[model samples]
Target: MTANPLAPSWLAPPADANDLAASVWPANARRSAADELVFAGVPASVLTERFGTPLYVVDEADARARARGFREAFERECARIGTGVTVYYAAKAFLSSAVAEWMTGEGLSVDVCSAGEFAVALAAGVAPARMGFHGNNKSLVEIDTAVEHGIGAIVVDSPIEVERIASAAERHGRVQAVRLRVNSGVHAHTHDFLATAHEDQKFGISLTEAPGVVASIRSHSSLRFLGLHGHIGSQIFGADGFEESAARLLGLHHELLAGGAIPELNLGGGFGIAYTAADDPTPVDVLARQIADIVASECARLGIAVPRLAFEPGRVIIGPSTVTLYAVGTVKRVTVALPAAFETAPDDSTDPSAHAAAGHPEPATAVRTYVSVDGGMSDNARPALYGADYTVRMANRVSAAQPALVRVAGKHCESGDIVVHADYLPGDVEPGDTLAVAATGAYCWSLSSNYNYLGRPPIVAVKGGAARLIMRGESIDDLLARDPGIGSATRKASTAPAHAEPAPAQAAAQRAS
Candidate 1:
């Protein structure tokens, strides 16, 4: 089968549309003897039958292994340099009580950016001393809660946050540890919206301003200044950005150490993962060694001891460990005109008079199939939000049909509701077929919404041939229960399991009660 001109240059027609790339899928993902997609030893059909469509299936063992891999790799690398490392599971990627427990069990700390995330970590019984708090605009209440709970560190984003955290620590009669987030002025090679360390962003203070902020933090009697923190961006493919950012931050670290003890240096996590066949991210172990080398070289050059290193890796650990299973609802193949670059040149053999009479040849066109699924932006918003690309496969069963170029779309009302912008699926793909999108474990669930009134899908953890819900799917009653007008009755009559655990807010309120 020839490649379609409409397809992106990076997307090639696969030899077998049913084949799953090892780097883009969970370690345990495979095809069963019956040709059905099996994740963590459970068939996709069984999962959809039990949990319904648009379900998130996370490989428990895969996630744990990745977490352990990061911890061990960084530990070994940093140890070689006579220093230590802390791998914080960035909860903003996707957090559940189960996930928090998994990270803690793997000897990793948790990084929470909100009170709700903090509450979740606490509810999971994670030691507050191992958790770090982060937010550009944290409320006073949130700061107070972090201080009162004895958080390991609160990454101060703004100058005002220093005073807020200091006041909270004073009120709680505790000495709080804080890290000032600084902009290293390193522009990571990534999407503009994702690049954070650039000076124009809202994330951190300039390198120039960081000194004053650190001074203010040191002035506070109740605050312990840890060190500086910086995050370059997400989906980074190489180590150059980390190297550059570390060089800049290390320079600042050297100047600050002269004033007082600076024990830790946190380069926040934006590590990338393989979302599709086109993505080839650096291995965690290799990346760890590279970063360690960069930090060691910079510190040695500056004639300073290497500080304790910290990283918050969220996506690389979890992104490829899960897949979203969607039921195909519709399939429509439409002929689209190819761009001018793809158009064929006028034939020289044709006479000028004949060509003039016939006019220019009709624009080249190609067929693109739109495969609509039961879910959309509500379940996975990356495609619509970041214009993220993903690869899809026929999940319920495999076929020997030729590969067909497809655009997997969501059921949402918006035209931008896409799941996989471009991929090859079996030509026989049609309604009732179940499709799986790989590498959705990261921000998908955390950024999911009720757009078009679609309830969020449940996340199920699969391992050793068993499946269990880590989070329950939202039902219609769950959505209606939020309405003040007609929701009162719905809330009272809703038959959803009352045994389900409370959300962070509910948990906090329960503690108060």
Candidate 2:
């Protein structure tokens, strides 16, 4: 990055802005003579003109293929190691009864982090035993519901959670299987991972605190301690991270065995998928083989049996399968100079270059390409949250013109709300044309909100020129559907975590005290 120091390595100057980059996009995505973006053989322009702008078009075949890839890969790798394996598609990435049915039909397990997700899975007809209930702060009622439903496993994040789950399981007269989430403190990048002795994350119990929980759960007849689980982080493209995580988790397993404890092992997924040229997420088959190899060797070294492997990858399985199609609402060409970070940063630095434009520093007197679309932070918040970068193209038409450095933005009121940070676009890009942002199928819709009171985009599944609506857009009336009947009064909005259940506040006046 010429201007920014921390620019991601995958950002690059596109050789052809009009051409489709196959790695980050669906296999069938292409540009047609009409200059329209086509996915699954349907033109995005046609979809927009038919369905309107700010729509999410999922390549149904592609999504199914990705889910199958992970399932088959893990199955094959586990067979080679003579061990058991399971791939739990994290439902929070993007869920619908439609998607759940597809995943279940392909033989993949479902991992739900919330009650709403569990409800969707059941409504979609996925078997209860194939569902894995996961959460850091699951309510007692949630645990009771999962126990009553007889879901597969509840990943235990804390000892208190184990107690609640055990109590709920006992009340139901069922022995609930549990996995302890261990914070291994492994910091992993795309190509490198370091296993540290101490971890400082909020999600999991310390290694020291975990064994006691395992021992505690072992004492409870109503609960079954199935294994150890560790999720290092997300968007990792290399095997070394898994290797580090696996070896460390097994090391703990060995320690547990020495204390007469034999448990399964769950290495949580952050397996990377390419969002742009900067990302090189490992293929599912290759990554599974490598991780399986690591676990096998580690078990041999520790003189223990190889434990079953579990993965909960949301991005790799669903990310590349879908793309967000948007209509260019406004196009703004801004004059900007390259920032010092991009120009001065070293090549090997994994830092963000505040001035990087399309993997390089913004040049002095550079004409930045800023295209505004109908959706912003409401549709996808990763960019604004992590300063993440993305790529977009002229989806409605093809341009045989030179590429210009541009930033794609949304119509939200926040100046900080941007979609594609910096990328090359054909100079002639304009309004009324369609734009398809790549690698959004994972986090975009899953994290979408009603910010600015704007309607959330509908998710439409596209297959063989046929499209079906999965989730309809919200209306103003839908936004106010739950309003209280207090005359001339409105409750103050709460700052609860997104996607988490709402924490409602009472509006009672206490009868004037």
Candidate 3:
């Protein structure tokens, strides 16, 4: 098959379809002597036999290495620059008791955005003083829970939240450490939805409003202002935005601390990880040094004592440590009409899927293979949600067949439920073959759902040639257990919208009754 016009320019055809790119795959993923894909000494076939298809496999060692890398790199950089640093594992990426326990063992703190995540951290034996709670709109119960637990820092996002925390802390007879979240007004070069630092987003208080919010916290007897925090956005590959965010944030940090001492400055994490060959993520050590130099330079120039620096890198640590395994169920060949918008399409496109569509004639269409897998948007929604890209490989065996342009899709009914929009795969790919998608360790499982009523898959941890089910897949019984029986007399009908009317079947049943 010829080169695909729909394939983005950044995507190059793989020399071998069976080969997995090192940047996106787990550190320990490799092919065994038998030519079967092996991860952490466990073969893909063995994992499927035991855990079933559509399973999330985490390389325990890879995750630990990443955790240790970030911690060590930051500490080393901070020491060289004569500053202190703290590395927090962002639990929003992928969190479980085992993962949290590993983080604690590595001497890393946990950053959570919800009460459930906080509880998980505590359950994993993470010290309350080592946990940070972050959320733009936390409920009163969540606030009270954090206060009662003596959380290390509650990143106060709004002025109203500062008051809520103060009240909650007073009730608990404790002084809470708070950091005012600030928007630096610098937009990160990423998907617009993921770009945060801009003032228009709903993440943090504006740069203009932060000083007053800080003063409000200082007035509360039950609150102690820890410092200022800023998170530009996620999947960021460059240091310019971090430096910019820090420069603006430190100006405020310097101004506020000159009046009163604040000990910490948290530049929130959005470090990027490679999802495909097109992605080039900054190495942890390099990123650490870049940030360290920026902070060191700023503090020295301002003639202020260096405040403790902190980071909350979630995706970078876990994203490359895991892969989603699916069992191919069906394969089809479909011809798609080339839309009129691509009439002037360049032979070298930056992103092949980055095209506008207007219906074109059937003669201009192209035929591509569609490989359907058991999992879809329910397991990994990034593709559907953000037009994210991922790479996949045939994991069951090494095939010598020539590569073909293919689209890996989910079993869901939605046409947009694509896992891999376009990729080169072995032409011999078939049903029952195991397929693996790279860099899914971050948001895939964390954002998974039971859409189409499909049971969620399990997570299997692999280390030292051993594979264990860290989380069990949902069963039909488990799904139904939470569902109130449809005919239950005690069940009350939920209030519908005022403009809503009963369905035809429901109205007919009501009339018959």
Question: How many residue pairs clash (N, CA or C atoms closer than 3 angstroms) in each of the candidate models, in the order given?
Answer: 0, 24, 2
Off by over 4 Å in 1: 190-198, 344-361, 487-513
Q: What does the lDDT read for residue 345 in candidate 1? A: 31
> What shift in Å separates residue 492 of candidate 2 from its native position after superposition?
25
Best by TM-score: 1
Query: For residues 107-214, what per-residue lDDT tens digits would candidate 2 score against the true structure?
Result: 898999898999999999988899898888999888999999998999898888878998999999999998899988797866777787887776879888877988
Q: How good is model 1 by TM-score?
A: 0.92
- Kindly give the stretch of ten consecutive residues in candidate 1 with the minimal lDDT sum: 346-355
lDDT of each: 0.86, 0.78, 0.84
Assess every candidate by TM-score. Answer: 0.92, 0.87, 0.89
lDDT of 3 by residue, 1-513 (tens): 346666778888777888878898999999999998999999998887777778899999999999998999999998898878888999999999999998888879999999899998898889999999999899999999999999998999888898899999999999999888898887664433233445887888887788789889999999998898888888988788888788888898888875699899999899898889888877878989899899989988898888989899899999999998887777887766676555534332223443435554233445588998888999999999999999999887888887878899998999999999989998778766778999898999899998877778889999999999887787655565578774445445432211122333443453344
Residues 1-513 of candidate 1 have per-residue lDDT tens digits of: 567667889998889899999989899999999999998889987887777778899999999999999999999999999999989999999999999999999999999999999999999999999999998999988999989989999999999898888889999999999899998887664423323444887888999888899999999999999999988888887788898889999999999988998999999898888888988788889989999999999999999999999999999889999999887767898877666565433332112232244657555667789998778898898999889999798888889988888999988789999999999998888777788999999999999998877788899999999999999988777878777787464455553322122333442353344
* Worst window of 10 by summed lDDT in candidate 3: 495-504
Model 1: lDDT equals: 0.86
Candidate 1, residue 296: Cα displacement in angstroms equals: 0.9
